[model samples]
Target: MGKKFFVAGTDTEIGKTTIACGLLEKANQLRLRTLALKPVAAGAERTAEGARNDDALALMQSASIELSYEQVNPVLFAPPIAPHIAAQQAGKRLTVSQLAGYCRGTLMTPSDFALVEGAGGWRVPLSGRETLAGLAVELQLPVILVIGMKLGCLNHALLTAEAIRRDGLPLVGWVANRVDPDMSCFDENVETLKQFLPAPCLGVVPHLPGASPAALAEHLDISPLGY
Candidate 1:
């Protein structure tokens, strides 16, 4: 079995996919086979193949082990909205068990590294009672948090880390992605996170526009992830 991690973010548009792909690229640099899965994604466009999401596509491109689009992202919603709402709009039900089943095959594939990226944040809803966190819990995978560095990141990162621990999952590592270029005291904020979050700091990615996973990979250190 590969080293698999459930990647979560502080919030939406917080570079979760960016950090995940970067990690995959880093693994590839070390000649390590890699796989990535985005089991549930909202916001997709119709494609020749089927409903496709940009984030999932990026992950597919980054992984050394190839998988079909459906394999990488089994659940896709057309509207760019919360997944639970999108499921309701399409008359479909989103459940943690169903999503976990979608991911099991790829997770079991032979590889040195694998990642299962979640939609939105850790507490994203799948149904009235089930949150996306339950899927990670079901898999019993350790977590890698992506913090979008900016104002209020301290609170967001701490609360997210707390929730992951509260769910009885280990927070293996975290990445600090500089989403806010102009945020004051950025170094101090990162220092605060290192002080508070109960995990090793994997990387600190500066804000780079239109950067590819290969470029972002230079900013990350996958050593702490046991690569």
Candidate 2:
């Protein structure tokens, strides 16, 4: 069986997709087949193909094993809002079982790697009673956290790591994405995380003018991830 990983983030807009695609690029470098799944997505735009998400599109480009947009992002919400709120506005119901089942089937595909990304954060709501984290637990996939390095990153990263551990999910590794290029003492903050978080720092990505998966791939070191 191939390896499956859950790409989670400390908070929204924290370079989760950037890190996920970089991992896909690394798998491609090893000539391994990869499938990237964004099971549920919000903030979609109408396109020639239909409503699509930029993050899902980027992931599709990075994936080695091609699949339709629908296959990659099964549930899409038009409003640029929280998933549960969007679902409620659209009169659609989401459940942990549904997403878990989709992930299970995707894992059965013949691929060297499968990376699934969550919408916002680990505990974002999929429904009134169920959270996206519940689906990750159901899938039992080890997590790769994307930490957006900035002023409050130390607290955010540590808290996110603690929550993942409390949920009994293995924090396989983490990526340090420099969102704020001007943030002072950047290297020191990274060193502090290394001292605290148990997982290895897979990579420390710096700010780029126009970053693509292939471009960011050069900055990432996936050796510690064992993929």
Candidate 3:
């Protein structure tokens, strides 16, 4: 058994993986056994062994210990679109119950934490009737939100925070990832999130040239989980 977190982002490409990397770095620094999971992936490219997705691979790379890629990303789609639609287009089926079942096993293993990064925005559908929110509740884990700092970030962060609250989930903390360098009022936007969110501000991820997990983790904050 281990402490776990559900990582959701304000939007896709909002540095959710970057925040997960930050937490993974901290777990490794503490010498704690840890793993990161992206239960569903929408985009993928060819690898020697069929196909693979970058988001899921990035999280596994950040972990100190190695885990089978399937253990991390249980549901994968080839298209870069909403997972439900992608599943249909790819002639596959995805359900929240299936994801929950896999994650339950992953969470049951011995470790300090398992960070599960959700697909797209917090509300993306995994199936026609179920949402990512339902999966979060099924897992019964606290949430760590990744807010992409850019124009209109305030609205995204606040609305997502509200949804977390509505689901009766504890917002463990949040990370601010600087996605758009030119977005105005970066500091102000961060401050706004810090004030409005029902959780602590874990850390601020500043944008760096040439995307890599190591650099992002350096700035990402992994505070103590109140488990």
Candidate 4:
């Protein structure tokens, strides 16, 4: 068994899936067996058999371990809304324990590493009072904060790190994802983060279309994130 990490973003649309895949790709390149778990994914597309999220699909692509879709994405909702609301519409109850059980069963087996990706932001509701932060706390895995480089991102990143710290989870490192091409002072923002954030900037992903994980890994300079 190896270190399991919870990959969280400052906000939705902040490239959590991209960063998770990049980690898997990089670890696999080192010839380590890896698996990815999405835990809970809302806004799924319906297929002939069932529904799936693109993030889930990408995780499946990156995972060296073959897991059933249910193992990778346990709680899935058809609509793209808050997990609580989506679950309500479908008459399903969402809870951290349900997700935790799935992860336990799936990841209990030995492997080089496991990366569990959370949906939405850290404080997004999983159920009534169970936020993603609570789940991360329960799992007790080191966290990889994915900072989407954009206007107002500094506040988002700091606030999220504070929340994670308050939750008492380990802040392993972070990735600077350039989601905004026109984000002014991007390098300056990175410099500030390097100074303030206790964790290293694992990577700074430049804005590019069709950027492979191999290319992303080249720019990544963070010390190996975990044991």
Q: How many Å off is the CA of 140 in candidate 2?
A: 0.4
Candidate 2: misplaced stretches above 4 Å? none
lDDT (C-alpha, whole model) for all candidates: 0.93, 0.90, 0.83, 0.86
Lowest summed lDDT across 10 adjacent residues in model 3 is found at 218-227
Between candidates 2 and 4, the lDDT winner: 2
Candidate with the greatest lDDT versus the true structure: 1
User: Given candidate 4, what's the lDDT at residue 92?
Assistant: 86
Question: Candidate 1: lDDT over CA atoms?
Answer: 0.93
TM-score of each: 0.98, 0.97, 0.94, 0.96
**In model 3, which residue pairs have backbone atoms overlapping below 3 Å?**
none
Q: How do the residues 62-145 of candidate 3 rate in per-residue lDDT, one tens digit apiece?
A: 886688988888888888999889888878788778889999887777788688889888899877888887889998888999
Clashing pairs in 2: none
Across 10-62, the per-residue lDDT of candidate 4 in tens digits comes to 99988899888888888887777899999888888888768898899889998
Q: Write the per-residue lDDT of candidate 1 for residues 13-36, one digit (tens) a residue.
A: 999999999999999999999999
Model 4 lDDT on a 0 to 1 scale = 0.86
| Model 4 clash tally, residue pairs | 0
Which wins on lDDT, candidate 1 or candidate 2?
1
Stretches > 4 Å off in candidate 3: none
Weakest 10 consecutive residues, lDDT, candidate 1?
Answer: 42-51
Following a full C-alpha superposition, what root-mean-square deviation does model 3 have from the true structure? 1.6
